[model samples]
Target: MIAVDQHPLGRRGTVVANNAGLVVMVKELADGDRAVSLTNETGSTATISTTADALGIANRGPYRLKDPWTKVPSTNTTGTISASVPSHATVVHRTAPGPAPLPP
Candidate 1:
């Protein structure tokens, strides 16, 4: 994870990439707002959140996969902060499999 602290005003923070062809960008707004953006290599960007306090926000991105998703070059922002699947990406919940019965 890339940690950016005290980033300059009007400047973006750190950027990270994953094997899934996704790029994540962290931005520090001039008005003390923090935001996170996820973009594919194709240049499609999805903004996660823009809030003064990152701790209070529960930002969720659209990217979801059946396989495990890993973030390359782990990232973290100090001051405050918070997508890439798609504009229609929505939350998905999977039910757990039940235990098999013992043979009679």
Candidate 2:
């Protein structure tokens, strides 16, 4: 895909979560943003979650998340990044750092 090919997560990637049919990974982009990928391969829906600290994002706090497929933009203030993902689907988010928000 054009998007995937264009934006690549550098070599410093971390697998934040993983299991039989689900996987979550994150990496810091060249510009200091982040790429968080949540994948579901089973026959049921799944809720994937992780913290920015786990994602290796050491920024202050709040972060902006944008899903490439849906073009929906969201935010994270508690360092928690989560999503309700459908079966056999993958949600890739491009998160940009924002001003620090309150703690979790």
Top lDDT hit: 2
After superposition, the stretches of candidate 1 with alpha carbons farther than 4 Å from their true spots are 1-8, 42-84, 87-104
State the local distance difference test value for candidate 1: 0.34
Model 2 off-target regions past 4 Å? 1-4, 8-14, 70-72, 99-104
Cα lDDT computed for each candidate against the true fold:
0.34, 0.75
The digit string of per-residue lDDT tens for model 2 on 20-61 reads 888998766766677888899889999987778877765656
How big is the positional error of residue 83 in model 1, measured in Å on the Cα after superposition? 3.9
55: Cα error in model 1, Å: 10
Q: Residue 78's C-alpha lDDT in candidate 2?
A: 51
